[model samples]
Target: MPLFDTHCHLDDPRFADDRAAVIERAIAAGVERMTTIGCADTPDAVGRALDIAKAAPERITATVGVHPHDASKLDDALFAALEAAAHDPLVVAIGETGLDYHYDHSPRPAQQAALRRQIALARAVGKPLVIHTRSAPEDTLAILRDERARDVGGIIHCFSEDAPFAKAALDLGFVSSFSGIATFRSAEAVREAARALPSDAILVETDAPYLAPIPHRGRRNEPAYVEHTAALLARERGEAREAFDAATFANALRVYGLA
Candidate 1:
């Protein structure tokens, strides 16, 4: 079955030495398409993922944003660049932006401010969003609502929350995208959420170079390992692997507006 890795960091330095090989392996392993997230740490680097997507436009798309960790760096110049990049055909979404209170790499206020601005940008550009919420569920949901992000909808990428959270996001037009965390032994809550989510509201990702699934848990992650996370979700939800894969692949295309 073909799979879609809805969220990944193909631009990460870890893949610099063999990025093409990584993409080849992903294709060989059945990942037909992937969205590489662009988290610009500086004003000038905003189009990093778009450059990668340009090379493989048929199979890859990109999202551009200021990650909450780098929220404080999102000055006017960076936001303007993000505004321009959002108009690119290869750029399908407007984030990977949201609250990340867990690390506080950027102050909570700055993160919230950045998130609101990106939501507006997503609405303005007529694209969906790719949200990254960590340890700030209430605030994350609140900002999404306050900013009227439902106008554009989005994906709650790397979902690590519970069933209630998934339902809440779904109510606002955002779907849940699972990562390798779904395959971990200690993530019962995530598994429960996965099982409870409607098939149409689900997606799978590797978050490459970060969360690698079991049997390859300690190794560097790549898009190829998304199959493991999909398999786990299928088993947990009592659906056939082919059916589950097809649903997620289609769902990703739909949310990213490629459908």
Candidate 2:
């Protein structure tokens, strides 16, 4: 079955020299669709993501928002640009937003404020959200609840939280996206959580140019490597690879409103 990489950053500078080759490789590897995210870390990040998606509209889509790392930089002008990017036919979601206390690149309050604003934008634009939370589950869940994120739904991208947290997110109508981290031998906890989640509430991503899966563990990641992560997740869930692929592809389309 064909595969889908639900989250990645094709606009990362690491992909600059061979962006086309990377996309082509992903397609050849049976990665039927990809969603490249624009965290608005830099001035041109959103445009870069859109251009990549536009280059292959049928097989790729893009998202726009400010990352928690850049939370302090977010302002009216930036949000306006993000909202404008969301209007593009190729734009399918409203983030890579949420709290990231592990890095603490931005202040905690700034991260919270940025997350809330993006959640509101997601609701306002009627699009699903793509969240990133690390070392801040309580605050993440609380803010999500307070902001009524359940109404619009979204994915907990690269989920690393425990089972109860995953359950809480599921209860709030969010899907958990497993990344290459789930394939790591050290990630038994993550695998257990993936195994415990409802099949329909699960998804897979690469978070590429970041967490490269086992075997490729020390190398740079790209969309084509998502198959490796998906394969491992399929095995952990005890579903046939084909079945898992179809389910995740459907779940992704549904969550992103592309179905």
Candidate 3:
């Protein structure tokens, strides 16, 4: 059952009190690696994961860029800092960035502009983009096409349940990632997409602190829960969990350039 979480927000305040304990618990649960994203507060005040990665440099990995809700924070100061900080080896990806029309948290234009800038920076820095798209798939893909994001390459993070959208993204050479949504009773399409990916094309994320799986539905998710989704995916493919995990983890590492 050894596996990787692929995505999480150990920085979120919920983990602040016993974050180390949580990581230890996950490790004991056989979760091997986790990506701590850059979509946090101001660069200086990012939470424990980045702080730990900075101090230890290997226990966790991280990405750079602002989340849509925080797009306004991608101002010059944050942009400049992200550019400088992204060079760190601990940082392997450049986003969690993209459009989020569901919440319409930030102005759509602002999210679009930030997405473009982060894409450019990711290309310049030679890191994979950690994309986050929701309810704005058309424009999200549109912007990526317009910005020529294929040159940089990245994942369609926490992918939409729509396989037509999955096919469209895969056609662009982007990896499709599934989160716990795949385990939802109502997410047959998402589950099927996970099963249908061609060899070396699928990845899974917890989107942790959110979207926990069936047994833990509506609960706060963490990296260890990735295995549950992995189990379901493996079952769908009629393969053993370990082999499926190996393939999916390899796909994620390849996508994020962890190798």
Candidate 4:
């Protein structure tokens, strides 16, 4: 089955020692393509993901933005760098940017400001967005609306919200990309949301180096493990695994404008 891990952090320190091996494993496991997010907290580091993508352009693409956790660092210089990087041919999207109230790593105001700016950046560059929202659904949706993010659309990476949130996001032109969290027993709301979404509005990801799925729940995650999340979604929706995989792969391509 072909798969697309629509989100991951291939540049993360965890993958530093074996990034090539990890990509090899993903391809061996049927991940045909993956998007490595470029979340720079500093201006100088903005090109990290682009460098990775450039090395394997056919199999990898990248998104550039400052993560919500480091929203405070998105100053004029970094934003300028992000704007320049956003125009790179290998860059398919403009974020992993949005609100993260769970950590409040940056203040709520800063997160919101960063999200608004990135949404505008996405519109400016004619690329979709890669939103990372957690525990701030109302505010997240409000900001997206206020910023007119629907103009460029995007993916809600690692969707942890419910059906209503999914529906709301879809209305704003954002598709929900489910991650390993969907496979957890306690994530009933996520499962329900997965079941309820239209096939085209749903995509799957590993969000690797983080939410590894069941049976591999406690282990370090990589692109190869995205299949477990896809399997869980297929079973939840009572769809054939092959069909689900194909649909999600195509959805990722469509959302990223790769198709």
Candidate 5:
């Protein structure tokens, strides 16, 4: 079955030395397409993400937006850069942006402001969004609704919320994406959340260099291992692995506007 890693950070420094090899492995493992997120963790992350997509245009695409952690840095210059990046041919969406109250790396207010701006950017650009909400579901949902995000739709990347949150996002035309977290013993609730969503609203990712699935847990992640999460998600949803994989792949394409 062909797979699609709907969200990943291929621009992360961990893959700098051998990014090409990583892509090869993903393709070998049946991942046909991958969307590399351009979360503005650093000032130049968005540009770097587009560079990575340019390196392998046929199999990769990118998104451009500031991440919640970097919310404080979303200055006028950065917003201008992001707006310009949004028009890049390789850019498929606008974000990896949203609220992250867990770390509070950037204050809550800043994250919310950044999220609203990015939501507007996504709508203005006529592209979808790639949201990163954590520990702030209520605020996230409020902002999404307030910003009328349903107009462009998007994916709630690396989702870990329960059914109610999934329902809320689904109501806004957003889909829930699963990551290696879905394979964790402690992530039973996450799997349940995956089960709760309709098949077409499900997408999978590795969020690589981060949450690698079991058997490779605690180790660095990469796109090839998305299959493990896909396997778990398929079983939890009581669907065939091949069908689940194909459906999620198509879901990613549809959300990213590639379909």
Candidate 6:
């Protein structure tokens, strides 16, 4: 079955030396489509994400938005710059932005503001949003509802929330994307969350270079590893691997808005 890694960070410096090889390995492993996220306001990072998409337009695509950790950097000029790049023929979605109260990397207000602005941008540009919410599910849901994120639709990337949160997100027209973390033994609750998700709302990712799953937890992650996550997700749902793979792949396509 064809695989779609709904979220990854192929632009992270970890792959600078052999990004092409990474893509090749992904394709060889049946990952036909992948999205490398760009921050809403980080020009340099987003710029690199675009170039990666441009270099392999057929396989790699990207989304531009300010991540919650760097939300403090957003400004009108920054959004304007990102707006200009919205239709660059590479950005497929509008965010990796939202609340992250856990680290408080960026001020909560800044994160919320950046998220709201990107939600508007996504609506304006008719692109989906890629949300990154963590340890602040209630506030994230509040903001998403306030901004009517359902209008544009998107996925909660690398989701680690509870079943209720997942259900709430699904109720708001959002798809729940599980990452490599779902494959970890300690991630039992997360696996249950994945199982509890409606079939159509379930998608998968590697979030590479970040949450590598079992068998490769301490090592670097890549798109190819998404398959392992997918398999684990399939098992958790009590469905056949091939059937779950096909269903999740379809869900990924729909969330990505791929034609």
Tens digits of lDDT, candidate 5, 1-259: 8999988999898998999999999999999999899977655655988998898899999999998999999998899899989988789999899998999999988999999999999999999999999999999999999999999999999998888999899999899999998888988788878988888899999999899999799999999999899998888888988899889988988888888
Clashing pairs in 6: 39-65, 40-65, 40-66
| lDDT per residue as tens, model 2, 1-259 | 8888999999999999998999999999999999999888655565778888988899999999898999998988788889888888788888899999999999999999999999999898888899999999999999999999998999999989888899999999899999999988888888888999988999899999999998799899999999999999888888999999999999999998889
Badly placed stretches (over 4 Å) of model 6 are: none
Cα RMSD of predicted structure 6: 1.2
Q: Pairs clashing in candidate 4?
A: none
Model 1, residue 218: displacement in angstroms? Answer: 1.6
TM-score of each: 0.99, 0.98, 0.94, 0.99, 0.98, 0.96
Consecutive 10-residue window with the lowest summed lDDT within model 1: 41-50
| RMSD in Å for all candidates | 0.6, 1.0, 1.6, 0.6, 1.0, 1.2
For candidate 6, the clash count comes to 3
Better of 2 and 6 by lDDT: 2
What does candidate 1 score on TM?
0.99
Q: Which is better, 1 or 5, measured by TM-score?
A: 1
Residues forming the 10-long window of minimal summed lDDT in candidate 4:
206-215
- Give the alpha carbon lDDT tens digit for every residue of 156-257 in model 3: 888765877777777766788888888888888887777677868788888888899889998888887887888888898898778888888788778877
Clashing pairs in 1: none
Assess the local accuracy of residue 77 in candidate 2 as a C-alpha lDDT between 0 and 100.
79
For model 6, what is the alpha-carbon lDDT of residue 159?
A: 89
Tens-digit per-residue lDDT, 1-259, candidate 6: 8888988888888998988899999999999989998864445555777778888888888888888998999877778878887887778888788889999999888888988999999999888888898899999999889998899889998988888998999888888899998988888878888988878999889998788887789999999989889888887888998888888888877777776
